[model samples]
Target: MDSFDAIVVGSGFGGSVTAYRLAEAGLRVCLLERGKAYPPGSFPRSPHETAKNFWDPSSQLFGMYDLWSFSKLDALVSSGLGGGSLIYANVLIRKPETWFVNESIDGGYERWPVTREDLDPHYDSVERMLDAQPYPFDQKPYEDTPKTVAMQEAAGKLGLSWELPKLAITFARPNEAPAPGVEIPGGDDNLHHSPRSTCRLVGECDLGCNFGSKNSLDLTYLSAAQRRGADIRTFCEVRAFEPVDGGFQVSYIEHRPGQDGDPAAPPLRGAVRARRLILSAGALGTPYLLLRNRSAFPALSPALGSRFSGNGDFLGMIVKARRLQEEGGDGELVPRLLAPSYGPVVTSAMFMPDAHDEGGTGRGFYIEDAGYPEFLNWLVENNVLTMSHRVGRFLLRRAWSAATHSPKSQVGRSAADALSKGLFTATSLPMLGMGRDVPDGRVFLREGHLDLDWDLTASKPYFDRLNKTMGEVSKSLGGRYWASPLWLLNRLITVHPLGGAPMGRDRREGVVDSYGQVYGYPGLSIADGSVMPGPVGPNPSLTIAALADRSAERIIDDHRRNPAGRP
Candidate 1:
């Protein structure tokens, strides 16, 4: 029966950050992650591998993507050791100061217990640890990244606040020129023990950077935790936990590689004891676990499953922006080259002020340029009509050359056009938008599966305002707004799902306090997006990591005072 000073579950932003800090404080910490660790050159790329890249243990699949489809909307989260950072775009935007509304909005929901001032130092610390840096638009090859340029130019025309937000990517070494495929130059703390190179401009951030160009948590915080002797275990999924004398009892199952997909795989049951338990299993994960094990937590807060929000996420597309001639009106339409698949997943951001801003107006939000893996270009470029015409032209040229027996060595241009007629893919841009929407959704168990009762009932106005602004930004680029097909059905997808075990002044208000200590369970804490009282109105990753860092401090303080688990 081995006992740990602390047990951290789910190595996402919250878990990895907290685990490292706790280990650094001299605590014997054991970090548990449900999914496999994806080292450099291991992330799936080909069609066969991508098909199996999802998380479903019952079906014996242990992939990273954990997608949940509810009647209201869909939520996408990761299941790897580094958690969401495995697939996140790497933007490190802090929670806006004004946007952290303390005053209650539409009831007691979304009343944050902590303010930006409280988390500022923590934010700074996290930024340093992640090695955050803005996209090097000032550098050579990166200088002419088409979508980044288009986003900045459009925002200027619309009078919106736009800037290159710091991304968790290693485009270049410190004081070095930004060059593709250069070795990152350091190995003392590299967890993967794999060789890494600088960003190659392949636009594969979301798919998982095979070159290790992204400064993901696995390469940063988790690596530090390992160096500090933290017991980091992957493929170990926590199944149950509960309070006990002198500490808490934790139960989990070891998901061996081949057994992960076997429905009847022999259960590899295991359990441990910990003085303190920290659940960093993310918004959807933590809430689902807590709800399923509610019987064990007799005094758990009633607010456990309340205040679920999608962070006001909306996806919009601007396809084939017209390049108009300056000398004439409505003369000719040429597809502008935005190159949606050239750079990282996100390069620059545009901030739209809401009612909460300084002399602001509508619902607050952020719009960032979204990108995908370059391989997707093949999928998007397969326009039947366009390819048919190109194929016809190439065949006709070859036919004419053969009939005349002419040595037409200049058919190079014709051959090139046959492969890719790139109007749709070259000129299209996807915008990732998220903001402060009404936090009125609920999470509960239905028929033994996690279910969410959420809709746009309270957030319709916010959604309307967000979509309209996106449309204006699209028109600014001489393109038409293309709403997501899911939005047409009154549903949207959210990558930044937040708020489940929300923090509050007390148990009556939320499941945890400002320090992430569960109100009724003192030694048990939560350090993840589940603690967010409302939306962070920016990319939620940095804020989640910052808050977890703050939680680690309070945890260290508590452990020092007690020096032992509760009796």
Candidate 2:
């Protein structure tokens, strides 16, 4: 069995940062990622390819999306070399200073043991490593991106706090004008040895940027970790771990091609010993793993499965937005020229004050312009953009030309116009809102599988506020808002699932402590969204990375003070 100074599970915002920091400190670290590595241009695009993109080992399907459809809510998280960063929208907003609540929230979730001040230095360190930058909206071509302009205009008219949030995307090299398809200069080539480019305004950030414009974790922290000689093995899924005399013993399965998921044939497992084990398998993953392997850690905290939240995620779509014309009635409406399929997935964010804070209302939230991929526009257009009518009109015109024996040179032009940028898809916009929500959700193993017992009842008031505000934003844009179908059923999906092995002041309060050390276990730590005591009231990725960086400092200091059992 192979061994190391530390074994970090799941190369996410947390795992990647920890691996890099530890490797830099000259500690032997091994990172285990369950999903395959996605270099630039490897993400699926066609419907056929996308249909097979899911993470189900039993079905021999190891893809990016690892979905957990619990009774009340569905959670979508990534399982890849870079984890959620591969699928995220690349927004890097920090948790609000006031939101690092020193007291427990309404639903008995633990108070945050660490605060913004504690994470400030770590936040700066992670930002520098990821090369975070705001969308260059002030620049020429970027400024004219329709969704960005439209979002800004609507926020200004509605008195919402609007600003371009920082993105972990390389819009340009340092001190260079924003240009599409330009090579990004970096200290180390990404793990795949592929070249990265600046943002190409392709609206593919959430779908994995083929141009590598998004400064994803694989391209940044994980790359640096590799350079520092950290052993990074993808397609290695850890299944069990237990504390040992000197450290911990870990067991994992290696997923390879051509392996049949047969009932009779069990998977071949491997084991390793590490001086320390840091679990960074994300909010959904880490909790599920711990709950499933509870028998191994007999003295784990009672709060292991508590303090779960979706970070107040709410999705609502707005349609039929009007563009004010020179001559129109008091309430005339025209489809706006905002193309939602042109820029990165998210550009501008509108901030609403929280009741806990001095500014205003109920639990605070953020509404950002959630752009879609160019291909999704076609799906939207075909579903709701009068496709039948357009096809009928085209056939009629072509039939008329043929019957009249006319030279119809303009037929191709009409076909192109019908397929490109229809008003319905151009004006339709998805507003993504997330913030503080009641964190009373629980996760536990049922029949040896992970499940969550949570609902919208406790968080109803917070979501109501979010809905009302989304409705106002829609009306301001000359449209009506429709809640997502799932939301109508009081169910919501969250990419930012947080708090399962949450941190607290003591074992009675949480599973982990302020430095991410597991409360009862000495060398075991959790450095992911699973450590969040409550909702971060922001995108949460940056905060997760920052918290991991802070934890890494403690780990390095302890290692220096007491050299462990090593070769």
Candidate 3:
């Protein structure tokens, strides 16, 4: 078995940042990922192929919105070597300034342990690594997408504050790569290494970007970490950990591709040792791992799974179009003003008044532009009119249809056409509403499995506020608003799930201390969204990376001060 100075689990924003830092610091770091390391060409372009892409069903489920099957709420996450970063839209946004201050006493929610002052430098570092930049609105022609034009006009009429969104992308000189180590040049910033190819704007970022334009961790931090001598093993899932005299022992399963004549082969068991352990398996995965290891670390806080929140995120849409200039002709469908699917998942954001302050009746939603890929469009169209209970059947039928008839239907022209229409329509744009979501839920282990019990009723005011804002904005743009029926059925669906093992001054209020060190586990640490205490008022990836960076730095500093302290 291989031994390392540190073992970091998961390869998303948190684990990648920690691995890079630790390896650069001259530590032997091993990153264990439960999914494959999908190279640029490995991305599945067709719906048929992509539909088959998912993590092991025994250990986790990828597409379902519910964290646990029993939960009424909806949560969307991904599993792979780069974790959710593999399929995540690349939008990176810093948490709002006010989000750092304590809001618990104000009847709003839990407070963040570290303030803006403590996290700014880390955020700056992460931004540089991810090539974060503001969208170049002036360079591109603006189109009248439903959400973009509507919000702009609404903000203008209402005199509300707004601006073109910032994004993390490489849109520099056409057909050129980013100059080595040369920061994006002024006026012609190259945010990603793949500057040679312009964002084709295919709107399939979520399915995975075969174009290599996205600056996902696999291309950025993980690549850097590998160069620094970090050992990354993919398709290796860690089942549990046991504390040793001076380090830890990990048990995992090694999965192999199925043979041509056989069904999927059973995963083989394996074990390894490490001087330290870092859990970055994201909010969902991380908690489950810890819960499963409760016997090994009996001192873990009772709050291990308490106070779960999802930033009250929701998705909606508005579609409108102008009559073509020529009869029986398609005028250039309005180009998407916002890079819907090119840049980070969320390039822009807006803030609204807190629902709690408005007698808990207003909709507190942030409206932003989002994009959909061809496969998603196909799914939506085929299942849009079907009854809710029939969705699963519809998906299964569609899957079989594509498999038998058009093996490439997943990437078929229809998918692409729908995506183009969805993004180019003069009156179509996605509205991503995010509001304050209080952490009023808990995660627990049931029969050695993870389960979530979250309370979303308290979030009603925020949802109402978002709907009202979206309605007004849509009206201003001469369009109508439409929300996903899923929201009505499931109550909410969030891409940003945060808070479980939060940071605090002591173990009583949090599972980890201010520095992210576990309360009693000396050499164990957490560097992921699990440390957030409450909603961040924006996308959580940037904040998660910054916090992880800061934690890694602190770990290094602590080791320097006491060589024999913990390990």
Candidate 4:
């Protein structure tokens, strides 16, 4: 079996960052990613393609989206060489300085062994690597993005702080003016070996950026790691690992594309040895792997599956928002063109600072304008009776004019009006909420499968506060508000699941130490959201990468001190 100095599992923010750092540090590194790599323009969008766009190993459907359902929550994550970065909205906000609550909440307390100050330099390093930049809303064409404007107006009315958060996207080449929907530079040199284009304002970031504008891991860390001589394998799913005499032995299944279609095809098994192992398979995956491979490490922390949280993610919508132009006007209510599907998945963010500040109650959360694809606009237009009415009226008028007037009577003007009139889709916005909620949820193995024991009863107040704030924002924008569909059933959905293996001062509190090393297992570390002791009060991707950067430094120092890889 091939052996290496370090092996990192799952190429998300954590795994990719670790791979790049270790490779740069001159370590013999290997990265294992279960999903296939998605080069530019490979993400599927058509109905037939999307129909099969799910992660199901039984049917051999290996797609990007991986959905999981628990008793209290539904989770959506990505499955690809780039991991969640391929499907994330590209927000790269740092964890708030004061929002790191180390005290107890309703259900359970949150404590972080590493503070914001400890991660400042690491955050800078990650930001530079990802090429983070704020959405250039001040530019001409982007200045009037309706959803962004509407969000800012609502925040101003509500007396909240609103600003454009940094995003991992390439809007223009170096020293060039910002332009959308144009050919991007540096495509030939990218790892994917595919041409890419600038962001076209398609709101398809969550669907995977086919244009390669988003600086996802595949374009950044993974590519850098490969260039630095890291061995990367895709479609190789790690089943389990155990510490051997001097190193760890990993067993995995090597999946072949055509082989999956044949029932009689035997499974291809593979194994490798590594002096050091890093688990970056994300919060749920890492914990599940450890729980299933529990016998391998009997001295693993008791907090293996403890401190689970959804990062207080809540989804809501603001529909039929009135334009600021409608204010103080005597004419009919002019619906604002929020046009939620016109820009990136997220463009601007409004922060609700935590109660640590005076005159605040529970923990604070962030609300951003969420977006979808323009195809969804057709569905939105079809759902509204007024829109159909306008189209129907225009068609009837066109038919009458053709019959009464010239045979070549013009319908172009009326058709344009019909297509544009009463379009409610242009006036809707999706509200994405995330912040600190109680981290009381627990993960455990049930009948040899991973299961979650979580309830919203204890965190009801926090969610209620979030919903009430969203309701107020909707009212301020003259729109109707609605929570997620699952909310009525007391269930929540989260894309940013955090904390299954958390960091602490010692084994009693966390599965890993401040440096993300397993307490009893030297040379074994976790550099993912699973190691978050508490919820990061923003998009957790940046923080996860920063933590991984820090963890990689520790691993490098340890390796340097003991060249033989002894702990």
State the RMSD for candidate 2: 2.6
Q: In candidate 3, how many clashes are counted?
A: 18
Q: Candidate 1, residues 29-89: lDDT per residue as tens digits?
A: 9998999999988999888888888998887778989999999889999999899998999
* TM-score of every prediction relative to native: 0.95, 0.95, 0.81, 0.94
Taken over the whole model, the C-alpha lDDT of each candidate is 0.89, 0.87, 0.69, 0.88
lDDT of 2 by residue, 1-567 (tens): 898999999999999999999999999999999999999998999987687688998887788988889999999999999999999999999888888877744555449888889989988998898888898888888889877887787788878789898899888776888887788776237788988888888888877878888889999899989999999998889999887867988899887745343332445688888899999999988998898888888889998888999999989888878866643556555677668888888998999988767867778999999887877777767754567777778888888888999975766788975564567778888999999998999898889888888988889999999999899888887877888899778789998999989888889888999999997788899999999888998899999999999999999999999885752
Candidate structures ordered by TM-score, highest first: 1, 2, 4, 3
Clashing residue pairs in candidate 4 (N, C-alpha, C atoms within 3 angstroms):
none
Question: What's the candidate order when arranged by decreasing lDDT?
Answer: 1, 4, 2, 3
Tens digits of per-residue lDDT for model 3, 54-92: 554464332211233446666777777667776776777
> What C-alpha lDDT, on a 0 to 100 scale, does residue 368 get in candidate 1?
96
TM-score of 4: 0.94
lDDT of 4 by residue, 123-236 (tens): 999999988998889997899998898889889999999999999998877788779978876754667887877788999999888888999999999999999999999988
What are the C-alpha RMSDs, in order, of all predicted structures?
Answer: 2.4, 2.6, 8.5, 2.7
Off by over 4 Å in 2: 186-188, 259-267, 327-332, 383-389, 404-421
Q: Considering lDDT, which of the candidate structures 2 and 4 is the better prediction for this target?
A: 4
lDDT leader: 1
